[model samples]
Target: MKKVNYLDKFLLKVFILFVFFGSLYANDHPYIIVLGTAQDGGSPHAACKKDCCEELWDNRFLHKKVSSIAIVNPKDKKFWIIDATPDFPEQLDFLEKKTGFSLAGIFITHAHMGHYTGLLHLGREVMGSKNVPVFVMKKMKKFIESNGPWSQLVELKNIALKELSNEQFISLSTNLYIKPILVPHRDEFSETVGYQIKSKKSLIFIPDIDKWSKWSYDIRDVVQKNDYNLLDGTFYNINELPGRDMSKIPHPFIVETMELIEKDKNKVFFIHLNHTNPALKQNSLEHKNILKKGFNITKFGQKFHL
Candidate 1:
């Protein structure tokens, strides 16, 4: 056996340090990525001949998917999706390619059509994903387990449901945590929740709600407390949809929400835009007004690092 020299020992130490710090430098931060910003029906909604849907029909590039987001932990090479929207397949592929991270789990907000319907893609007929952890509130868990098609996914072991209680913190990684905050909404099937994601910088995500007034907490205070906020902008105002009684389907109009948290607009990004929302069009006057007011609208591929 030959003894190692001091020069060889020093070289070995340098190699080890290079590997350690290089790994840290490459994957030290986690982030939230905006997948889609449209409402449940998505942009260019079905069977509608309105100009909002008309314009997008010819311009496929401008089409938008339903609202959803993903929290990515690069260090672990894994990520979790907030909602499994109708655009799940595309969003999942985008996340995997963009961040090089495999999906670890999913957190559903409600049993709404867009929010959880994409779970169908995980069924045996589709991805056939085995034991994918799906976090949800009690009602949502029951709804999925008891309902057809969705229930089949559970029975086939495509996804494993994990029930969450209101306001309970779920730690995702060493520096990342998420808490489900229940909010008032049309709970026909399950409860609606907004997630508070905590890391080096925190964020509040509420894609759907009846109205800010109905929530227990003040929207102003939540905006001030979080570094980033993605709240409901389902419609620009009550007038967006003509003939239909807006009261029948209540959501905080962007105008109404702006009045409440105008001061902290910089931290806010309005999302889940209805197809008829003028703000959905980048060149529309409504879009410019939101920018002028120092508020933002979520765009596909927008990223917030933690």
Candidate 2:
């Protein structure tokens, strides 16, 4: 009878341990880490030593490259990068050190310099990577295939292009998938797209739409459909760049977006800020106002579990 009692207690302890570990594993979700929050040229913009830029130049205030994200698969030890910004070398280094894996592939959003220029680093003159898969839209693939310097990458087979179709879901794993959604933006060379990254527990991404009202689809509908939304926040207010004509450049200002999505604060996190935008300052009034609205502002090195 004493031997039976001992066996029962041991089984109970093993069962409890199994239950606890199962719960922990179930709660563990896949996540993406933000590498940068600044716009194309990045904070401390070129040729201008304004107070903000000058202050940022100090070692203490240095920021990462422009808006980019890394989707990490901890279990498989594989990861993918979205948007190869101007700071690709540094961003790749950071990912390599943090996740300890070379990039699996890179996804491009458009033909903009900040969006795809970093591919140069993968060429013979730089990393000399061989056959790094680069996913792009149809037009974007042609743009790179036809363009001079980029075409060289294709010829030398440094990067291979994978054409992405809109609204089609690409499964990254059993529980994670990515879908490309068309967004209205400057399509000078290629169409622009915002990715819908779906994990078991969350969904989010950078959707740089031209104007919410102008698009055939409604922005609110998209937000309602996703558990998390990291849309554009390129400017704090409409008049952010006073000297330059705002009409020439377009993005939904933070204030305007807040007004549009005031009711659905739970799903919004603003990203892709311009260098001139005061929201970059963590202690600024603009930042406080945004936080008060229950909306988050993205920062480099910040990770979100899906």
Model 2 quality (TM-score): 0.91
lDDT of 2: 0.83
Best by lDDT: 1
In candidate 2 the C-alpha lDDT for residue 121 amounts to: 92
Q: Could you give candidate 2's per-residue lDDT for residues 19-91 as a string of tens digits?
A: 9998777545568888878788888888758766887776645764688888887766678888999988888
Pairs that collide in candidate 1 are none
Error of 2 at 292 (Å): 0.6
* Per-residue C-alpha lDDT of model 1 across residues 15-127, encoded as one tens digit per residue: 99999998787577888999999999899999889989987788889999899999999878899999999999999999999988799999999988989999999998889
- Worst 10-residue stretch by lDDT in candidate 1? 1-10
